[model samples]
Target: MTWNCGNLSSKLATEEEYKIYVDGSYLDGKIGYGLVVLKDDKVIDELSGYVSDPDAQDSRQVGGELVATKEAIRWCQSRGIKRVAIYYDLDNIKKWATGEYKTRKPLTQNFKEFIDSTNIKISWHKVKAHTGVKWNERADELAKAGANSQGATKKNGLVDDLEEKAKKFSDYLQRRGYSVNYKGIYNSQAAKLSLDDGFQDIGHLNIYNTKKLHLVPKYHELRDKSKQSELEELWQEFLG
Candidate 1:
């Protein structure tokens, strides 16, 4: 669960702002990063990368976080975006941004230099991990997918497709006049299961169940179920 109830419908206060959430995943000896960019609460883009160097002195977790953070800023820069809001679960990274923490390691130095060189004005947000935040959870999924990646030729299509579908579904919800929380809907369902209870292991059960949960009548009343019949068909087609 990477989302919470309080922030489900949260939106950026200004039009010039872009929200970016970054997360890192370390599995076995591999490391990866997840980067998400959003505008007006709609996902505009995302990226993930795997770091193959296990011999690096810095831990994979730190390396992934640093790389994701640096690249996120670079992404904003490339887009000519000057006002950006960055969210991460790592406290050390937040502290480093605020001048409350410092390190002399080459990796850290390089990251710091990159930040100083960037002209973007960034607002930093520190969020609790695994609390059901939509973009944050998406980043976590991407990072895990990256960690599991074998190489350029072995990219994971399933994860990527699921992510894209989820974003499109979220957009659909917005268009349908529903302020749905993509990750929170799944978490709300998962919370109902008793501890130690095991259900059929659907691939990416969260995404699957979230779709099912929304298709019913209880979640929210549709503005026009008849008008949305076509959307329902498209949705089912994608899921199938």
Candidate 2:
């Protein structure tokens, strides 16, 4: 989703109104949502819980975001609150609710319907993630905590194995005096590896289908064919 800072209105709401920051996390097949409620810029409540649904597994982190917003709306309705502001990181959270984007998936359709049926007045604000935003960061931390609470489940063992291999490969490159950063997304069936030279990115690696791996040189003009061959040989050795 595109990231943009939405307008933050100058006229702030009164103490009677609520401001809620919501986030979701997905890890190793576990999904969780976190919500932080505030009034008059003071924390009033914090909520976090795991989601155990097959549909959520398909939507991944976005599913958790939907659940968090849904929970926030319920909290406001229960307290007889009329006005509230929702701070979110994902653009679809606001787009689906405001009809700026169409909801094709069943989970998203359900979420949009829930928002449409809610009586409470809701305003949405987009916040850039991991940018030192206090409540937003807190919400992310809580979401991760909730996901960790689920522990390990009977998910895709192959994906987990691939992730472990990716980590080992990253360490192998690091030991050879190369700067490496690896990230594995469980649901995507791929791992991304970036190789840097302490100044600029030198190359990238992608493991696809959990078996096939590809290395792409970042600057083909600057690097010779021998360096590319070396990286290929190293990958082959690691795989063997």
Candidate 3:
């Protein structure tokens, strides 16, 4: 089989086929992925790892998902297995592999090409996330653990300076009565920030390598129109 997208069937796979449950996690801006391989409903192997590639970092959890799936496929290939089923929480995993979604991003394009290069029979199944599905939940737990396992490496001067500025910006927003959350190091040079007004999210701020900042607003048009000027003022003040 090339690929099948939908819910898993009640029937179990044969002895020759393997079932792999995969999940990706993004924690504090670190991306990680986990996978559990099963044969006849018994665990055969488990894999988890942190993704450090800059391209994967930009894709976040989706990057982890694709990595997990690809790793699982490689594992099967190494063992001479030709048929496998992949269970995943994200729809994009299936969409990208099946050509249902365009692979505009570099990470996605690479993922699609990797899948095309493989000769194994792969089937994709969507599993509802955080619903306590046994293998699926295990994959999620492993993914989180992998994300937490990212090593503490020393940063360069530019990164250090950018992190300091991001912290100051967060503190400034908090002093102004807005809730500020930091997403740690987004990459080697940037960090992600989230802004909220107690009950609703205002937008995300990206602190870049050049010390420039950009806001991605999530506020509703009509309801947040009055607050636009205030946000602009905050941005100016932060830059100033």
Candidate 4:
């Protein structure tokens, strides 16, 4: 199976010796489901399947977990990772893999096949939900972001201006080898990242009453720190 765009990006962030976490939620006999991915407490990508299994009647039925795990496995395999740990709140999935349970649906079974198809060493851990863990918090953000993945609609007038400003800030971040995340709350609420000497807070630049301009990204390199100010200047000139 192929990955949704958000899943891929979320997986990429965890590349090369990073902790990876994946979460999925489904409702209504698996009619609507979404997945969230995280790396090192940062959101990489998320995806909600556009599945229309209308015949399903169980609204509480969760269908997206297996596919999400499949993508997670893909992420692990592609990186040639030999060992990793995953967290799942649901015990059935862990049990199924451990041969403790069985499901009639091929979803988790297919995931089992995918797991067997690979030689990587993986471990699953169960963590308490809503307990304020790092992985859980990050996963929550990713899942929520995925749920809103229809793409943010372009706003008009003032909203447009704020978005543009956010983009400009994000561009400035990218020029420094940092991935900009503009969808989170703007009051530094989502920033779990640390900036090197070359970075500046520049304060929150709000494009609207409800928005503050706290845009930060990971850019850490001793050699590159000096250029941070220069890029900031260019960003000002371009956005001015």
lDDT of each: 0.59, 0.71, 0.74, 0.45
Top of the candidates by TM-score:
3
Candidate 3, position 83, lDDT? 85
lDDT (10s digit) by residue, model 3, range 29-65: 9988899999888898998877665688887799889
lDDT of each residue in 1-240, candidate 2, tens digit only = 111224543243342367999999998888989999998889989998776656678888998898899778767654657778889999889889878899998788767766665556777788899999999999999898878866452265555556546655665665555655554443557666666655666666666544454322222433333456667677778787
Q: Worst ten-residue run, lDDT, model 1?
A: 191-200
Across 1-240, the per-residue lDDT of candidate 1 in tens digits comes to 011112331443253357899998888877888899888778999998775433322576787787678668757644657777788888788666545689667666656555554546676777889999888899999888877774662454444444435544543433333332333223333211001102221111134334444432221233333434554564566456
Which runs in model 1 stand beyond 4 Å of their true positions?
1-16, 53-57, 153-240
lDDT of 4 by residue, 113-229 (tens): 455544455566566766887765555455444434323422333343444355445434544444333342344233222222224432322233234533333334324455557
Positional deviation of residue 181's Cα in model 1 after best superposition, in angstroms:
34
Off by over 4 Å in 2: 1-16, 151-240
C-alpha positional error of residue 87 in candidate 4 after TM-score superposition, expressed in Å: 1.3
- Model 2 Cα displacement at 34 (Å)? 0.3
Angstrom error at residue 82, model 2: 1.2
Ranking of all predicted structures according to lDDT, beginning with the best and ending with the worst = 3, 2, 1, 4
- Deviation in Å, model 4, residue 50 alpha carbon: 5.1
Q: What is the lDDT of residue 10 in candidate 2?
A: 26
